[model samples]
Target: MTVTDTHTHLYSDAFDDDRKVMIERAIAANVTRFFIPAIDSSYTKAMLQLEADFPNHVHLMTGLHPTSVKENYMEELRHVEELLSKRKFVAIGEIGIDLYWDKNTLEIQQEAFSHQIRLAKQYRLPIVNHCREAFDEIFVVLETEKSDDLFGIFHCFTGDIEQAKRAISFNMKLGIGGVVTFKNGGIDKFLNQIDLEHVVLETDSPYLAPVPYRGKRNESAYIIKVLEKLSELYGLSQEVIAAITTENSKAIFKV
Candidate 1:
């Protein structure tokens, strides 16, 4: 099974000690494709270095993360624009509203989110969204930008069935990760209700690691735990789940 970790920060400093070993561990576990998301301009060099190190396995995206939007956001957006104009990226993400960190930046976050969505449309690329505690806010922007041209994966989706349907309505595939394995991680309870076609798998590594490793740094290798839980929920084999989700990722990233 060729598993695709649609959202992972392989360039994170958290893996400075053993990034290569960690990635190889994931690849050995069948998690071969790693789509790297941009947080801001500062991480761009590291992301590019990661791609250079693993050209066949790593795909890069350029965008300003909502939390990274601060006083000099215009400058950051300009960096994103410059990157897009210079090179090809699989998508324009992981971009979206994130209110968990700073509620004060909501306005600018919405502006940045909407702007990136337009950039995605302009580039004819899918977007990988990063929403946290701001589903309603995220939806408002998405609603205004709704069109056949707008489509992507809602990275680390942690919403209810209604929200899932709404995201799907906007042509987004829900990105399932370690959260589904938690006993209290609610999404697993109703995940099977959603068609597998509208689902994709991700690790969001160095962040939400799956159960048995929760609270620890997550790595792409741990994605197998997610695949296993999803199998049990959907009454399917791990290989099938991996295959389908990987295909769903391919449909979005087109690589």
Candidate 2:
């Protein structure tokens, strides 16, 4: 049962002390494929090095994260453009409006989000969306960018059935993570209503750890808790949940 962590910052400094040990732990638990999302140029080197070290298991995505979109965002997008032009990546992602951090930069966030969406479409790549406190804002951009060519995962989904349906309408697969294991996470309430094929599992590592590890640092291996929760919520076995979500991930990443 190989589980796919669709979005995780495995290259994050949070795991610096024991990165290899942490990854081996995940592999032992059958949580293998690690899709690393780009935050900015600052982490690009680490990301590439990580992929080189774990060439067969690490998949990469290049884009400007919403929170990283600041005064010189154009320069950052140029960095993203240069990478896309020169490398092979699974997607253009972890990009979208994040009003929760800096409401003042909403306009620029939207602009960057739209620009990256175009990049994804142009490259025929899937997008890994990161939306926080800006569902309406995100939907606004998705409304305009809607197209057969625009498809991706709504990373770390935290929405109701209505919103899940809406996200699907925009060609996105919902990324379910540790939040599904939280007592008040809410997605569990209506998640089963949405077909398993529309959802994928993730841990958003070094963040959003599942129940036993909630409020502590998250890691890829902990994704098993998420898979277990989905199994209960969907009335399937842990093995089945892992297999289906892994297959759902392959459908999105085409790996």
Candidate 1: clashing pairs of residues: none
For model 2, the stretches where C-alpha displacement exceeds 4 angstroms are: none
Give the Cα lDDT of each candidate.
0.95, 0.93
The 10 consecutive residues of candidate 1 with the worst lDDT sum are 92-101
What TM-score does candidate 2 get on C-alpha atoms?
A: 0.99
TM-score of each: 0.99, 0.99
Q: In each prediction, how many residue pairs overlap at the backbone (N, C-alpha, C within less than 3 A)? A: 0, 0
Clashing pairs in 2: none
| RMSD in Å for model 2 | 0.7
Q: Model 2 scores what on Cα lDDT?
A: 0.93
